[model samples]
Target chain A: MKKLINKPENFVDEMIEGIILAHPDMVRTPGEDKRIMVRADAPRKDRVGIVTGGGSGHLPLFKGYVGAGLCSAVAIGNVFSSPSSDQIFQATKAVDGGAGVLYLYGNYGGDVFNFDLAADLAELEDIETLTVLGRDDVASQPKERSADRRGVAGIIFAYKAAGAAAERGDSLKEVAAAAEDIIENTATMGIGLSPTILPTTGKASFDLPDGEMEIGIGIHGEPGIHRGALETADEVAERLMRPLVEDLGLSSGDRIAVLVNGMGATPLEELYVLYRKVHRIAEELGLTVEKRYVGEYATSLEMAGASLSLLKLDDERLALLNAPASSPFFREG
Target chain B: MKKLINKPENFVDEMIEGIILAHPDMVRTPGEDKRIMVRADAPRKDRVGIVTGGGSGHLPLFKGYVGAGLCSAVAIGNVFSSPSSDQIFQATKAVDGGAGVLYLYGNYGGDVFNFDLAADLAELEDIETLTVLGRDDVASQPKERSADRRGVAGIIFAYKAAGAAAERGDSLKEVAAAAEDIIENTATMGIGLSPTILPTTGKASFDLPDGEMEIGIGIHGEPGIHRGALETADEVAERLMRPLVEDLGLSSGDRIAVLVNGMGATPLEELYVLYRKVHRIAEELGLTVEKRYVGEYATSLEMAGASLSLLKLDDERLALLNAPASSPFFREG
Candidate 1:
C-alpha cells in the first residue's frame, strides 16, 4: 500500500482534521461530529442552505466546497462508502436556516437511501427540505434511463448553479429546479488508466493488465463499456468528448462549459494536454466554449486518469456560474 | 509510459496551448513563442516587473504563477530542461516597465546561467534588472552552505512576497530584496514514494524497489539523504518537518506559514494527511502556524510524494502572503 496514512481506519478522520485545522476561517464542524463540515458562518438568518455529502477520498468534492456561495455543510463517509443517515441529518440540521435546506449530491444507491432518510428527519424538525440528485454520468445508463445514471464530476456544474440560486434567495423549489436543470444538460465520461487501491483493504479496486485502459469508468471502479490497450490523449479526448456532445444533443453555435478533471494521480500537464484536444474538438464542432476548468475538480483516490464534463449552457446557467462564489477548493466571480 | 500525452516532443507546447486557451483572461503568450506566458496586463506602466522561469512539468510553479500580484512573465522550457536565454530575454523585454524588472527563479545551474545572460541582454536594452535566487531546500545543503541549496516549493513564498512588493510599485532592487528576505527564512524538505517517468523517454527518473522511499528527494529526482522502508505519515512528516523547523531556528513565539505540496501523483487526501501531522508537530514545538496552504503547488510529473515548506513569518511577510493574487492555477487574497 503506497499511501501516506497512519492507519487504514483513521484515514478519513485524519484528513478531515487536517482540513479543519488548515481552513478554520472557511469551514468548521457544526458540533461534536468531526465528519460534518459546515461553512464557518453557516445558518444564515434567511438564505437557503445547501448540503452535499458522499464517500470520502474525493477531496474538494463534498468537503472542499463548503463556504460562502457554495455548499453550507457536508457529511463525509469513509472511502467509497456513503455517509450514514444520522450523519447526513446532522449536516442538514447544522446548515438549516429558516428559509429551508436542499440536499444535493451524486446519484448512488447508498447515498440516496441515507439522504432520503435525512430529509425525513429534517421534516420532523419542521424545517422545509428539497432533494436534487446529480445524474450526469452518461456511461452508467442509456438516455432512456438517465435518472439511473451515476453522478460524476459534472455535478460541480449543478453545485455552482444551485448554490448561486440559493445565494440569491431563490425558494427551495427554485433552487432544486436550478440544480435539476444543470444536471439535465450536463454529461461526463472518464477513462481510467489504472485501478484505485483502497487504503483499508490495501488492494486494487479492480484488476487490469498494464498498458490497458477502461473507457467510461466510474469513480469507484465500476465496470465500464470498454477495456483495451491505452490510446493517445487525443484519441481519449475524442472518445470522451464525442459521447458528451451527442448526449447533450449539442450542435453548431451551442455554448457550453468544459471541465477536464484529473483523476487523483494524473499530472496537471497531462490534463492540459487533454484539454487542448477537447478545445480543438469543440472548435471543430462549431461549439462556443464559454468557460473552461481544467484541473482536479474531482478524483478517485490515486487513480491515474481523467474525466471530461460538458454543460450545455443557457444565459441563466452561465450567469449563475459566473456569479460570485468561494470555497476551499473552488472560486468564481 | 501510462501518461496521457500526445507526441512526447509536443508535450510542453501542447500543455502551453491548453493553458492559453483555457485561461485567456488571465494569461497569454507574450509573443509568437507559446513558451513565453505572461500576465495578460503586462508592462504595468511604472510598476516593477518580475520574471520567473524554469523547466516545465512543475505546473503552478512557473507558468501557473504568471498573473497579477505574482509573476509578470515566465520563460518556459521542456520537461526537466532549462529554457533558453533568448526566451528569458523575450519575457524581460515584454514586461519591462520603466521602473525595471526583477529576475526571481529557482537556483538551478542551467536556469541561473540563462537568467543571468538574459539580465545582460535586458541591460543592453536599457531595462534595469535585479536577480534573486530561491535556495530553500534545506536537505540540499547544511545551514552554513544554504546558499548553494536547490530551490524547492518554498520558493512560492518568495513569489508571493516579491510579487506583492513589485505590485506595490517597489523598485527592482526592493522587490529582489523582499524575495531574498523570504527565501532566506524559508526551508523545505520532500520524500518520494516513486520515480517520475519522463514523457520523451518513457523512462523512470530513478528506480526504487517497491515499499521503499527516498527521503529529502529533489523535485527532479535528485539523490536524497536517506532511502528506507516507507514510514507512516506522521513519522514521515516528523522527519521532513523537524529539519525545516530546526533550519529556520523557529522558536515558541515565532509565527510561520506552512505549505504541504503534493508531488504530482500524490492524492490531495494524502497531502492533507501529511499536513495534519505537520500541524501537530508545529504546535508541539510551540510554533504558531499563522497561515496554511495544502495542495499541488509544485509537482514532478506524476511522481508520488510530497514536500513541506515553511516560511518564518513577520508582519510584512504575512501581509504579503495575504495580499490578493490570481493565476490560472493559483489564487490568493
Candidate 2:
C-alpha cells in the first residue's frame, strides 16, 4: 500500500502539473473546468480533429495517445472515474476545427452520458461532432449482446485505425465509420491476477485467492463472469479466447489480428507463452493472423493476468493497420 | 508472490510463442533459438535492417521496439540474462541486408559480450556491422563514470532516434551515431516501491517495507543506492531527478526532454504528481522541458515506483527525436 503523494484528493492535479513540467513541449492548459486538458499544439485547422478521454489511471491510453497521428487533445477524470460533461465539452471545443471533430473513446456509462452531453454542447458551439464508442470486450456480454461488452485494450486498435484515417483527411463521419468497423471486428476478454490500488483507498480494488483468477473482469475491478483456480498458460488462453472466437463467428480461412495484452502485472514472457498457444489455436481454426501485437498496450495498474483480443481483418483493415501511426501507446509503419 | 505461471522452465518459451501468436505479423523461426524474432514479412531488403537484443523481462524494451522505423529484429534471453552469442549472431545474420546491419541495444555485461561475439561472426559472413549501446542510467555510477550506469528507458529514446534515422535512409554509420549520441546525452535514475515476482521462484525479486522505497535500482530488481520511507510525489520527483539533472550538466534556460517513467505497479496519477514537481523544479532552475513522457516504459514486472530521465536536447538530438519513428515501445512524428 505504499505510494508517493501528499493527499489522495490532490493526486490528479499534481500528476497533471508534473506532466506539464516534464514536457514543456506538451501543454496542459487547465480549462475553466480543471478536468479538460488541451495540448498546446492543438486546434489544427481543416483537419478532422481527434479527441479521446477517460479516467486517469490508464496513462498513455487517454493521455499518451494525445499527439500527432493520434488524439490531438484528451480530457481526463479521476482514477477509474469518468470525466465531467463540462470537461469533455471543453476538450471538444478546444480541438474542434471547421472540418468538425470525432468523439472517439471507450464505451462506459459515465463516458457515454458525458460524451453525449458534450456533443450537444458542441452543437451549440456550431462544431459538428460524431461519437464512436468502443465496446470490444466480448467477455463482458454474451455474443447476442456484444454492444454491452466493456471497452478495454482493444481501443488501442481503434485509435490506430481512426488516427490514420483522420490524419489522411477523412471526414468526421468517415473517421467514425472506420472506428466502428474496428470495434465490430474486435473482441477482448481479460483475467485479473492482482488488483489495482485506488489512490484514495491505498488498497487493492478487489481481492482474490493467491492461486485463483477471475475471468472476464473489467479494467476497474468489476466482478468478472466467472472465478476459477489458476490455470496453465494454454488453458488460460483457451478460456479467454474461446468465447471471442465463437462470438466473432471466426472460422476457417478468416484472417485476424491478435493482441496478447498484459493487464500490467503479467510479464511479456508470460504474454508470449499465451501468444504461443493462441497462435496455434488460431492457425488450427484456419484463421490467418495477419497483424499481431504483444505487450502492455493497455494496463490495469499491477493486475497480473492477460487479455486476448482478436480482430477479424479484411483488406481494408489490414491496410489501415499497416499504415503509419505514432502515439505513446502504439505505433505502426 | 502470486503468479499465473504453471512451470518455471517454460516461462520464457511460452512468452515468446504468445508474442508471435499475438502478432502474426512478427515471426520467430521454429527449432532455432528462443531469442531470435523477426518481422513476418522477412527479406525486407529495400529497407535498412535494424536489430537489437538483450535479456528478457524488460518488456517493450528490446522486443517491443521492433517495427517499422525501428529495429527489424530482436533476440531475447532469459529474464535479466543476456541472449547467447550464437543467438545474437543469428539475429544479425537474419537481419543483414547487402547495405549492412546495425546492432543497437543496452550496455549490460552479457549483452556487450554476446553482441561483440555476434559482430565478429557477422564480419566473417562479410556483412557490414555497427554497434551502439545505450548506457544512460545516471545513478548506477558517478558522473565521472556515467558510462557505468545501466541502460534503462532512455534506450527507447535511442530507438526512436536511430529508427527514424535508419528509416530515412541514413547509412548504417549515421544510424549508429544517432543512437550513440542519444545514449551519451541521456541520464536516468530509478526508484522501486516493490519487487517483481520471478516466475521460477514465485517470490518477490527484492524486499521493501510497506512504506519505503529503494532509489537507483536496476530494472532487474537490483538494489538501489538508498532505501527510505516513501515520500510525497514532489519529494519523489526531486529525489529521482536531482541526480539526473545534475549529471546531464544542464543549467538554467537549457531545454531538456523529461520522462517520468513507472518501474511497474506505480500508477499514472502518481507519475503525473511526480511530473508536476519535476516541472516546477526544472522551471525554477530556468530549465525548459522541451518534451515529456510518463508511463511504464521499461518495467520491472510489478514493482512499484518510478524513474526520471533527462536528456539535454540540442538541435541535433531534437531533430532526431522529432523525426517520424514507429516501434511497439515508441511512436512519434
Q: What is the TM-score of chain B alone in each candidate?
A: 0.99, 0.93
Residues A1-333 of candidate 2: C-alpha lDDT, one tens digit per residue: 767787888887776666655555555664665556665677877778877888877765677677667777788898888888888888888888778888888889998998899889999989999988888877677777877878998887788788788888898889889989999989999888778877788888898878888999888887888897888878888898898898789999999988888776676667777888888898789888887877677777667778889998999888888887654444566
lDDT score for candidate 1 against the true structure: 0.92
Q: Report how far off residue A289 is in candidate 2 (Å).
A: 2.0
Q: Which window of 10 residues has the lowest lDDT sum in candidate 2 chain B?
A: B22-31
Model 2 CA lDDT for position B222: 70
Candidate 2 Cα outliers beyond 4 Å, as residue runs: A18-30, A38-52, A66-73, A95-107, A119-132, A145-147, A156-182, A316-328, B21-31, B37-52, B66-74, B92-135, B144-149, B155-184, B291-293, B320-325
Winning model by DockQ: 1
Error of 1 at B278 (Å): 0.9
Model 1 DockQ class: high
Q: TM-score for every candidate vs. truth?
A: 0.99, 0.85
